[model samples]
Target chain A: MEIKQIAEELVSLVREGKNKEAKEKFYSADIISIEGNGDKVEGIAAVYEKSNAWMSQIAEVHSASVTDPLVAADHFAIGIKMDITYKNGYRAVLDEIGVYDVNDGKIVAEQFFFKS
Target chain B: MEIKQIAEELVSLVREGKNKEAKEKFYSADIISIEGNGDKVEGIAAVYEKSNAWMSQIAEVHSASVTDPLVAADHFAIGIKMDITYKNGYRAVLDEIGVYDVNDGKIVAEQFFFKS
Candidate 1:
């Protein structure tokens, strides 16, 4: 899979709530995921665990949409809009842009930018 | 100017420290600018003032680079990496993604995503 194809497929899987599958297929073993605040999670397993922890806090997923992916060499970015209700009944709509750095057809680094 | 052209030119002007000229040439009179915190600044004049205030805080810009822009219809995004020394002697490197929404060949809205 090329960078663009990998990005598109991963985004499709995520939009369908198949994040684990997407990670299994597209992430490199030594993947590094960086949050907007500069916190880093090293390794694919760590990234998955972080994502799962976040999902566990959501009471309901109202809606989600992934925008067209943008590519620049081995880098790709996708915009995401998600509406969710948390366990505390707080509802929020989040807009985020995720940038993925690919190497050898696998995502090596991923960073997210969003309002918080 | 078309969306892509406008975006490229605006970024070029900014990188050259000609942001005021860029704003005058590319921004719509009724432009709205949104920050990562969801705070909004309305009108071109207001946006210019915001930019000036930010610049005033910087003692020196050690380095800056504007990445290749990505375009989708009337929307475009550019990544910026800036290393700066603030007036208070605090030095920080900031990475930000700026998204622009264009209408009628002028920038009508702009939004920035970054870590504080």
Candidate 2:
């Protein structure tokens, strides 16, 4: 798959709340996910667990939108806006940029940046 | 200026090593620049000082490329790749995503995210 195709599909899946499918299809087995804090979760299994933990805190998703994937060689970025109410009844709109490094058509590294 | 126009020109100026010009033209007077560590420099003058401090440590810039600006309403993102040699003889390639929030055609809040 081309980098754009792979990235777009992953974003589409996530926006649809099909995160498990997105991970299984687009992530490499040794994928490394890096957060804004410079911390990383190595391996697809570990990253999946982290994603689950984040999702578990969401009580309701009000809206979600993913922008078109902007491709730059083997790297790409996507803008995300997600509005939700957390399990604790805290509601907020989360805007973020997700940058990915692709290798052999599968995402090997994914990093996210966002405002606090 | 439109958001795309503002973002593209800023990236172009920075890629050309005219960062001061970029800041003066595109950044609002009260612009807030946020780093990956969540630290921020408020006001244009403070941000300019921060930019200069970073440039002073760079012995040479080997290459720089800024991707096309991705626009989403009043928000935009640009990818940057910079190859540089520092004053201490350390050479590294820096890749980052810069996300900006623009108000009235000037960048008001800028945040950066990258891996360590």
Per-prediction TM-score, chain B alone = 0.93, 0.93
> Which regions of candidate 2 deviate over 4 angstroms?
A1-9, A12-20, A23-68, A71-76, A80-116
Model 1 C-alpha lDDT per residue in residues A3-79, reported as the tens digit of each score: 77888898789888897999999889999898755699999879888988999999999998887676655667787
Extract clashing residue pairs from model 1: none
Candidate 1 chain B: worst-modelled 10 consecutive residues by lDDT: B67-76
lDDT agreement with native, every candidate: 0.81, 0.83
Q: Show the lowest summed lDDT stretch of 10 residues, model 2 chain B.
A: B107-116
- Give the per-residue lDDT of model 1 (tens digit) for B1-116: 67678878988898897878988998899998988666999998799899989999999999988876666556667877889999999999876667777788888888776653
* Steric clashes per prediction: 0, 0
Query: How displaced is residue B100 in candidate 1, in Å?
Result: 9.1
TM-score for each candidate, following the candidate numbering: 0.57, 0.63
lDDT of 2 by residue, B13-109 (tens): 9878787888788889999898866789999989989988999999999999888787666777887788999999999888777778788978888
In angstroms, the error of model 2 at B15 is: 3.4
For model 2, what is the alpha-carbon lDDT of residue B64? 90
